[model samples]
Target chain A: MNALSTTVGPPAMSRRGPVSTGPNIPSLVGSEPQQRGMGIARSRLVFVVILFCAAFFVMAARTVELSLKKAEPMQVTKQHVTVPPVQFTRADILDRNGEVLATNLGTSSLYAYPARIRDPEEAARKLVSVLPNLSEGHLIQKLSASKGYIRLQQRLSPRQKWAVNALGIPAFEFAPDEERIYPHGRLAVHALGAVNYKNEGISGAERYFERRLSDAASTNQALRLSIDSRVQYALADELESAMRVFQAIGAAGVVMDVNTGEVIAMVSLPDFDPNTTRGVSGNQRFNRVTQGVYELGSVFKTFTLAAALDDGVVDFSDGYDASLPMKVGGYTIRDDHPKGRYLTVPEIYAYSSNIGTARMALDLGTEQQQRYLSDFGLLRAPDIELVEVGAPLFPARWRKTSTVTISYGHGISVSPLALVTGIASMVNGGRLLPATLIRNSEGWRQGKRVIAPDTSRKIRQLMRMVVTKGTGGRADAVGYRVGGKTGTAEKASNGGYDRKALISSFVGVYPMDDPQYVVFALLDEPKGTKATYGFSSGGWVAAPVVKNVILRTAPLLGVAPKTEDEGLYKNVALRIEE
Target chain B: MRKIVTISAAIAAIMSGVMVLLLNIAVQEQASLNRTLAKQIHDDREAIRILSAEWNYLTTPRTLEDRSGQFLALMPLRAKQIVNTPATIPLRPRGQDVDTKGASSVVLSSADKPRKVKKNQRKGTAL
Candidate 1:
């Protein structure tokens, strides 16, 4: 055992000492060759370790690059397949009070493949017996057409569908479909808008939320608007009455929340029934509240006064010379009432004096006036949810004449919606929130401040003075404290203004101390009547409408009427002498 | 010992097979119940949708206003008619304050008050 151990130990120690010395012993072939093989194995092990590190380094670098890099935009190419179309069930539209304004009603429509029908005349006779509305001649002609398919009836009641199916006629089939029905008929036609027979939204709020309304997954959820149905009905009723009494060609009105800018009620008279909008006149479909642009005369005076005050150029007590008409660039601007005396700023607003307003605009100049109007969101199209929003028309060149005329609301024209939104901003603590049709949309928008709070208070006082003593006296609802400005503009004709045709409008804000709502009423081309003493001015035609609307809607909006003394706004009331 | 283990394993196999067959039957029955309940829920939802539409149609403001105008004498409540606080209500005069608490009915008019009987008259004879 000792001899074996001694021989193995000495050889092992010698081999370890020169293991890396490759092929050093030339004579001892077996032992040295084995050592050389061990050296090659050790070198291969180091090479493998280095290779592993290099691979790991590449992976780490790629991971870092991927983590820090921005992802590229994804593009999806369209691919078409000839499968049967899936009919969409639309979501219902509800008012803020959870009253359903629009809903999808299930219906069945009859169609026949003309080429496949065995007997067209016999089928027509059977169908007409079931559906008395369809003329037998028309049905026969449609069923026997050379076309591939023809529709016999668009909307059939369930009983009618069953009756036709009982006929057992070949090639005739009832296709299940849905119709968008506005239950209130013409009550909210302009705001709810109308949808095509295919259940596709074509205009108004329907067109605004078309994607959300048509989504199948959202069918159970109803889209709630900011409008209250009771208030909408009252506003529409009052405006319709005023239209009938005044003998106007058309009328438009809007009620809006001052703080959130949510439109409560919008009415455009001569509106058609949304249920059957086919063959309705284009004039009936024209949404005057949002789409029609008119020079809303003395209402623009409110802006002129507000802008002058906001710029620190004038105050309520500051007086302007109005003894005579002021001439600007070959055009003379005069007050319709023509109070031939120097008038204070409040008197100018209350009396709607064109001479005084134009003089103030001259002092403010063109640049500041344009800036103030633009800040009021009058320069561009109002960004409302409705697709029928109109772009305001302004003069291309802001010359002195344009400034003067625009001050009295002649040269520039804007939709009723833009006017109300601008006034809402002026009175609502000077915060300019864009008018919205969507409920709870205020969470996303932090309104931009356009005027100072002090200026807004002063403007409210002057507007109240207008209703109490000036041109808008008819709009003063006793306890409601209705404050507004009256505007009457001559409709523009071929290169001149027509005196006989006028656009009368009034803008009112109720509970003027802390303004909550803005009500605007406008009438187009109203004829003079004995009740108005042969006058079709804003004070006579439009102010009464504003008063009636405020009186009826204030209670529904949870606004309480105050006593006469309490109704007087707690601000510096402007005392003006006629 | 090997034979005993084989016998026990065979017995276990047969018992487990029977138990599995029983569990499968129970699961299938529960699945069928779930399917039936799901169908009932779907049918109820469809009925609710139709009923809601009909309710809206009946309660539309225009229809309600017209119907009320035709049949009922009720008008929209005026601002003057709405009294928010109890303090605004006029107080009754002395001797007119009736005990209304815990009473099912109260006499609103002087004519509706109960008549007092005379001392010499009998109650049944007056009728």
Candidate 2:
């Protein structure tokens, strides 16, 4: 054992001596390697933890941005974008009874981002197929443009938009747009007017009420109109029927509430559809009631007789010699059917005697006549919603000759609107209310005084007399108590009155005792037909139209039929000498 | 010393548990807010759509005519119906109240002007 120990100790001592050449070298080296490995592993674990935290924070920020911001998509290309400085327009236009007259609708307009389109031909083909209305040449021209973006079409229907979208053409896109639609085809086209592609009102009541319709301040309120759809349709129907029956060049009619001054209905024939007014002719587009001025022949006699009675120039007992033809200004004014005897004032109106009317006007004198006519709203343009209003044509200088010719409705011209409104005031208790296309509210009664109540009553009596015993007899509705005046003026040709061209018209008021409504019908250049034995008199052509309209609309308006004992006609009936 | 260590460990565990609960609640609240905002945006879009549709419906010519006929009792207007109130007519009475009568009676008596029968005019002629 000693010998073995001595041998191992010597080797261990030699090894220790070599290792101790440096201080604790073997032990230090072993501990240093382990420490280095542990440090690396710890640093790696820390890095992993930091990465997880960073990932969590990133996810939280992404979620917040998506949920909280609701940001609009950023535009990727340079394009013209008009950012509205304020919120869009107000509520829609509705009729008096809450029917929609005008409204805004969402539509899609097709645009092309040329930079994004991969296949121009394919996109063009797809778009053309869906929008067949576009010409192939136009489509090709549009697609071939070198511009970054181009508007392909405006106001595409939803179906068309969807069809275009389904093609998956990357460059083809839809832009949001607004469009206006007039649902009722051609019924009230002239009254309602039309809008452009941008939903802006261009004409009619729509244009007149455009500001109210588009005002953001009026967002919740709808613009109401005084027009009644029912009455408008009835008038249109009657006028169209009249046109067809008479084969007249054109026709027009109006129905107005006498008491309220509300325009119940206004119909103009040969009217264009507001829905598509692209190809409407100027003649068809003319609003005859408000824009076309005509020499409304005998209808003017109502005003003439009313003036005479109100001015104390004539009374029921006043008589005029209707036997002679009055020649004034180289024009012989004679009644179509001369009585060949003295006619009472009431009889003159009843028979629409031109000679008597001229005599009455001569007695009133030109200044008085012009003043009365101006007071009746005849010397100016008709008050209406449209910008297109016709002014009454009167002689620049008033003279005795002019007065005589104008007395029998031969020298002046005025729009049908002016005539109706004037007659409305005469029969509606003498309050000259401005014609309004918008619906009346509680505050709409503001109007000017045109005449005395007594004068109105007298005029009403005369009007009733004409209906019951004169030329307006055909205009009488059995229980409606219709009173009116008929005008059959020869249309002016090249500086002369055309014998063949006649403007036949009838203006009537119902229940003359308390006139509630005034209706007027006019036929332009109406030809003489077999129905009238080749005669186009106002009574033969225009009066019956008013009668039919009154009869048909009376029940609809809730105006009950009157009994014979109602005593409504007592004051206006002519006194027959026993 | 051991008791102190055990108490410290328990406190740390409780704190961690509370933090986890708070985090869970925050996540739930964020989800609810997201849903509410989404719903509001959807509703606004829908309102815009409805208003647009109504505008189109109102402006159509056919709809306007129908409404006019149904509500206003209006007839087709003519040029003759419009008059210059001051021009051709005489001064009417002012401040006179209208009397109420049946519609039919009003129609009959309103047209007081007697129509001149043309020498060859026929009776009961349709307009």
Candidate 3:
């Protein structure tokens, strides 16, 4: 209505002419003939209209093309159609620091459909080149057996897989299967335990937590153990070296958090790899820390003295006449570290005097001794996570002689774990915390108070004196104030204790003013070595290992190395030894 | 003229039906594509698990000890080599690598532990 409807002449000029007459007139006048002008204007109008129509057509076509586009056939690939759902049959076992200890790993096993396989001899010949372990004739015999399918190899290296694939045999195929694997093989074998070929947990933590680990719902999450692999490695490394150096039959060590009772590391040397556990000797698999029960020698004196002090039957200043061997019920009691004089309580403990300790036990009496030892968790098997825990053997009768002998860690047997757990109690403010393998085990809060705090302090002092003034001097790792006892026990043989073979052990607590960790190392029948001055005693063979373990694991546990009098952990100033 | 109008309407109806069918096909294709991507993600996760195992195997203590070549003298860190606290590290004397007065040596023994600041230590670091 405004312009297009009102104008029949060229719309462009008319639209412009109505608005600006001056400019339009000059252009109209200076232009060519009116007829030529009309013709050109009409042609231009048709061309512009056609151009608009063409552009509209193009847009319309594009709209249709986009809206009704044919879909490419669904590119459903064979792999997409056949992807297997990921299911971890078992939960991963991880160290406290979240390092992978044991997990299931899928390995490829090459197999051949014998019926479809053409030229079996050729295939075997080619396969043998890549896998030299499989003899060509044996492989051919198996391949040509007319069986449904025969295994060429159970485990194929990546290179072997590629090499076999390069040969392009259609009949040969790989079947994927998973096997339980321990990346740190043999490093934590005793603690982690073994698994069967069917992926069933057989021993150790594996057997201990089989249900939780194998359940589908819980398998997605990993089981974090109280164990620190670094600590485990160090303890194993040191313990193995000690065993080798001492020419020992076996060795065991445990490093535990004194307050939490979380076993940081448990090592038993002459260990086997959990990965390939076929033909492993039963003796090699025996977990000495948790399963093997030994008398554990004078390490028990700490318990006896702790018990006596706890019961208020003995004081630190009290003295015992250790100059003479005490005869109790036809049993003669003597001291390996014989100080033939009146020995104070500290002297009796530091010197590991069987006579003095026996006198203390006799003062407490048999009933009192048994009660304390039972309370200290020495009279029963350690309720640790492993299924292979040892049932402690002590005198069922609890005779007066038994009390005297058990006072110095004889006439009874306990696992290394039990001894360490008991020591953890004696040092950790008298709370007998439950030993645990699971990370962040909250069972310590429910710890039973086995002794008075004052008594625990006194026990720690005695233990400290053992290292500072007595047999455990070799266990003192400088800057970290170690306090411990050395126990060199005679292995029991026939009707009596063997005079030759011995179990030498040292159990240490660090930063004695405030004990945080307990390190225990024991060598079973470690023979005399030149380096140890031919003394196969705990002070000589096992104490150095305790020192090595402490030195290596202190920083890892964030226990700042301090001088004996450095910070809150001041020197354990015992009363002057008279 | 009536025939032309009817024919144009018929063409329009057929095109609309075809577009709807094509759109439906497109939706199906996209859904399948989504399934494919999901499958790919699952496969990637499995691959990651395998690769992580391999990585852990390679970085095991025994492996690292063996792989520690001549150029790298890999020895277990001793406790004495560790510095206890930052305060004992002795304020680099506000100077460059050049010799500076009142500057303490970099090496501090365990005995020099001025454990004044003990923060961010492993109280079961990041449960």
Candidate 4:
């Protein structure tokens, strides 16, 4: 037993020794403890790795969710962002003084997507309630149309828009529209012209400057004019009053600055308000100042005499054979009040002798007459801001008969503006400037020379003489030194002069010694009144109107009342024979 | 050595937390600038619309004429009232000349001395 125990103990001890040293034996022998430690460390590392992976997965998922959300919104925004096409709109029309004569304001016109309207009748009823002017039947028809969009009403006011918006109908939409407004009422209607519903200029200065006002590439700036509102009002008032007093069909007047060639005031009676263009007659829309060509009676005598004086055919003291009635061609040239005696140049103008004027024209000849008339802006249309100017109706063939009749203002028919421009040049030191409505930085362009300064002075004296001593006596405003000529021509009927129908007109210049302004007033087919003593001459009808106009406007224009000794009147006034 | 390693690890963790906080603040500032720019653009568009409307209102003829009438004390002009620049524009009288003219002729009385003429009036006359 002792031998067997010793053998087992040695073997066990040897085995134990080998087990302690061997790699797999110790791992096996202590496997439980090692496994426990390895399990704990492995579990801890695994836990840390799992936690890091979970955090990374969470961050990646959050990033993907945020990017998806951002992508959806960006795509929606891209779809919603609409770029509108570029287009031009009409420009505004303005008065000479930078006042808005006409302008376009943005308006919202209500339209409907017909397919989207749930109940046509209910929608129409609501629309008609907001817009009383629109008929219910019209609105219903518009809403029931098969078209994609139907216009229910145009030019809706802001209040109306708000009322329609408050209904909150999904199908309703507002399309932008442009509307024109004229704020001056009826003032300067003839000059401002009228526009279509689309705001296109149809006539007058509006039409003349249409491109300037409508073209965006050019400018959207306002147009400044030479007109003074105060001056325009005063002239229109006097002209309207005269028209009523004379019982005339129509009357026209113009006020122009002689130096600048600016039209300060222009009036045509029976003018229609531009704001409401409907129901206006063609005659009411006519700008008689620039459009009507009339044989403006003896007012032509001033131009005739000025031509003679400028051509050196007649001097201040020159005399003509006025004793006998001059017969040219088959026509008899006789004055209304026949002097039947030879008259000096001044007498010819003061008495307004037709025979003397005819002889003066004959001496000046056709070439000189044409040259002078062309220089006076009578051959062509006057340069004005309005497009309604009329060309003078003179004989194409300037024969002896035409010349003789045109001398006393019979054969030629010209617009009131033309006559005014011519007279302006005659008195404005021979400088023929184009008449302008715009207030230019540099005033009227100095045009071609027409007459000499001396001739202009002489003409000024003749005009003054007529006002003080002859037919224009009633037109003489005190202290203002008004100078003018009276013209009363028989209107033509069936190629012959009418005894009953007459065109009476007056052309006047103030402070004649150094003439500054030219005034022209005309009465179309004026009838004789009891106050006029059954006479409808320019002196009886048009002179008084001009006289009052000058008297009232001079002080307002800052022109001091002239004393008798003032040099302004020294050379221009003629000594009247008692 | 063990203690030193532990202290270094603690400082690194604190710095990482601060870095995350700074990144969050940077993102917030960028978003705020974008909003402010959008608001400014909206305001500019509104200003343009109001200015255009006001410009149209001020230039209407009826309003301008009414204002001019009140300010200038003017009347309608006749052709006869206008002239070429006079060879010589008459000068207004000084002290003695004003006295020679009756008080009625003078526009202003002693109570209302002729003050300085307005700049608009001067420009109008010059034109």
Candidate with better lDDT, 2 vs 3: 3
Model 4: per-residue Cα lDDT over B1-127, one tens digit each: 7567667868877898899989889867866766666666656654544455466456444466578898998865554445545644445432233443454664233333334444454321221
Model with the higher lDDT, candidate 1 or 2 = 1
* Predicted candidate 2 versus true structure: per-residue lDDT over A1-578, tens digit per residue: 23433423433454445434555544543577756875776688679879987997998899898899878787645433333222345456666666666556567889887777666677677777888887777776677776678888898888898898888888788888877665556767788888876677787877777787777788557677777666677778888878888889899899988766778788888998787878889988888989999999888887787777778887777778888888887877778877788888777877788899899999988888888888889889978777778888988988888888787787899999998999998987778887877777763464677777788887887787777777778898877778898889999889998998899999999876668888899998777789789878888889998988888777767565553343644554543111
Q: What is the TM-score of each candidate against the true structure?
A: 0.78, 0.73, 0.79, 0.71
Query: Cα RMSD (Å) between model 2 and the true structure?
Result: 16.1
Models ranked on DockQ = 3, 1, 4, 2
- Per-residue lDDT over A437-487 for candidate 3, one digit per residue giving the tens place of the 0 to 100 score: 988755345479999998888888778888888889999898888999999
Among these predictions, the greatest DockQ belongs to 3
Instruction: List the candidate 3 regions with Cα displacement exceeding 4 Å.
Output: A1-85, A117-129, A135-142, A145-153, A163-168, A441-444, A566-578, B1-29, B65-70, B73-81, B94-127
Q: Compose the digit string of candidate 4's lDDT tens values, residues A1-578.
A: 23433423323454345434544545553568856875776688679879988997998899899878745534445434232322337665565555556666667898789999888899989877778888898778778876688777788878899999998888999998877666556777787788877778888777888888788875356666677665676678788888888788999999888888888888998898887788899999889999899998788888889888888888765778788887889877778867777777788888888888899999999888888888788888888988788988999999999888888888899999988888988898888888888876675468778889888888887888898778899898877888899999888999788987888889999877667788888888888899989998899999998988787777766555564444543443343221
Model 1 global lDDT (CA atoms, 0 to 1): 0.83
For model 3, name the residue pairs that clash: none
> Cα deviation of A545 in candidate 2 (Å)?
2.3
Local accuracy by lDDT, each model: 0.83, 0.76, 0.84, 0.77
Q: Chain B of model 4: TM-score?
A: 0.43
